[model samples]
Target: MRIRAAEEPQPGVKWIDEGGARMKFLEVDDNTIDVNCDTWASCEDELHARHLFIRWAQFACCWSQGMMASKMIN
Candidate 1:
């Protein structure tokens, strides 16, 4: 994922989920990005993968909503 400058991710901009865990958004009139994290698949041997995805999704949503990332940040 690209860590855009403060001026890039303007407020009120929404990220559109295209498919396969990928998202698309326009940073500006010309600059655009397709963020992909499509590795989230069924893990035949590891149930932990689902848990990991859930945890990560929660963290991301909270952060986007202006909640603290974590209380245990080191």
Candidate 2:
């Protein structure tokens, strides 16, 4: 699949499902991305977020080639 930025692109973070039950977040037009465990994926209903916690950050930068990824099962 092909992923493209918005028409008028701005610095932001985007989450996506990368098949095989794998999930990830991609940073667009940004040098770095900060993803804390307090984000919306915090609900206990999301099995992937269960181990994550508030103020918990895994990676530092999420550049185009770089990835801040997660998994979602439904």
Candidate 3:
């Protein structure tokens, strides 16, 4: 599985793809993000969406911490 910043069509986007499942993220504000997902192999799109949001939140937390540490060191 791989996750990366998305380009084009929208700004402040993130995406993840893991074979059968795919997810997208859109930053609504500094503290909020909207997550969308489609799990073609499963019937629980809602559950997948929640999972994607959690993963993105984890990534965002780590990313923000890294940026803060970088700023402090510089």
Q: Per-prediction TM-score, please?
A: 0.33, 0.16, 0.43
For lDDT, candidate 2 versus 3, the one ahead is 3
lDDT of 3 by residue, 6-36 (tens): 3345544434444455668888998666767
Report the lDDT tens digits of candidate 2 across residue range 1-74: 23555334544523333312223545655565433322344243454454333222432233222542432221
Which candidate has the highest lDDT of all?
Answer: 3
Reference-based TM-score, model 2: 0.16
CA lDDT of each candidate?
A: 0.48, 0.36, 0.61
Write out the backbone clash pairs for model 1.
none
Judge candidate 3 at residue 61 and give its lDDT. Answer: 77
lDDT rank, highest first?
A: 3, 1, 2
Regions more than 4 Å wrong, model 1: 1-26, 29-44, 67-74
Higher-scoring candidate on TM-score, 1 or 3: 3
Model 1 score (lDDT): 0.48
Q: In model 1, what lDDT does residue 15 have?
A: 32
